[model samples]
Target: MTKTVVMILFIAACVALGALSGAGNQPGEWYQSLNKPFFNPPSWIFAPVWTFLYILIGVALSATWYDENNGRRLVLFAIQAALNLLWSPVFFGLQSPALGLVVIIPLLVSILMFIAASWRENRAAAWLFLPYALWVAFATLLNLSIVLLN
Candidate 1:
């Protein structure tokens, strides 16, 4: 099994799990209610953006998983993924942006560590997470806004 193949599997797992965790958040009800920041892209933008991001994450992890798959970076990759899953349900389903924001802090930190660690293992792979990191930063701001507005 090639490392790329393994990482692809892992990335696919993240997206599949993420979508499942978000199953309860109906777009009609949940998304329509939120007070999005002015900077928020059209609601339609999320799927594609995350889709691309998931691919990148997969490449990144697969690269790391390719290298050794037995390091702290690999573990952090998993941790960040778990954190990613929690954000959607917390914010959209429970309608608790505050708690979601709280949860995301650790997620954000985990991602940073993932990037740094992945960089040490594979610079290209680390770069793969850059968009995800940026998106999360944007989301943190957006989440803060939603909490404040609603």
Candidate 2:
């Protein structure tokens, strides 16, 4: 397959997997009853934001995939992806914001690590993760808030 095709596949797979992870682990009454911070965004915003971020993440992954020297980058990508997928289940499915904090803190670190690892080799890939990093930072704060409030 062509590189373009492979990149597209990566993006599609990322978006699909992210959607699937979120679909089964939605916030029900338990989440609604929790005391949220005033800065909490409306529920509708998460899907679109995550979709956009996943697209960036997929592109970053694809960008690094072809590079033989990117083993560390790939590993960081996988770690962050796994952590990302685990967050919803811990936070919403199990209704444990404290556990979610445990997952997200490292997730944010891995994302930053990925950006740092990719910076010299593939600047675009690192740049792509900038928003993801910022978002995760915000999410970490939000998760911490939820944990403290309740």
Candidate 3:
């Protein structure tokens, strides 16, 4: 019962924190300014997709909690999450697609590193991150296209 509660809270907090990175700012304004790539998903798709991704991230984070008190992995996950949050404000709020592209590169690397680290400690948890890594990869490409086109 306690573990379930903990997982719920952990998922909620992580998703909230991630949401903070992209919360403010009117969508469609700056976003429409960008020359989105052909492959870019509709703007309406972001909210639902990110909501799902956050749930996955929550699960991934919870998986780490099972591996003893490994503060290092927690810190790594936090670092990546913070970067994930920052990308939105940089890209949309500030209207800096180039800067957003730069930001996501490190975020991508951090997530990859997190997956690598988790692989050593928990393979299942690392596997959960695979979708996230793939999404970031697509995001990176989309950002690059936006930067180049706009």
> Of 1 and 2, which scores higher on TM-score?
2
For residue 75, give model 3's deviation from the true position in Å. 1.7
Ranking by TM-score: 2, 3, 1
Q: What do the candidate models score in CA lDDT, each in turn?
A: 0.80, 0.96, 0.84
Candidate number with the higher TM-score (2 or 3):
2
Query: lDDT tens digits, residues 1-150, model 3?
Result: 577787788789877876665577455565776677799897777777787788888988888987875688888898898899888888877888889888999999999998998987888879988889999999999999988898
| Model 1 misplaced regions, further than 4 Å | none
Estimate the TM-score of every prediction: 0.88, 0.99, 0.91
The lDDT leader among the candidates is 2
Q: List the residue pairs that clash in candidate 3.
A: none
lDDT string, candidate 2, 4-53, tens digits: 99999999999999999999899999999999999999999999999999
lDDT of 2 at 25: 99
**Tens digit per residue, CA lDDT, model 1, 1-150:** 765568768889767776677565645676677777788788778888888888888777767775765488878988898889878878777778899999888888899888887776688978988899999988888888888888
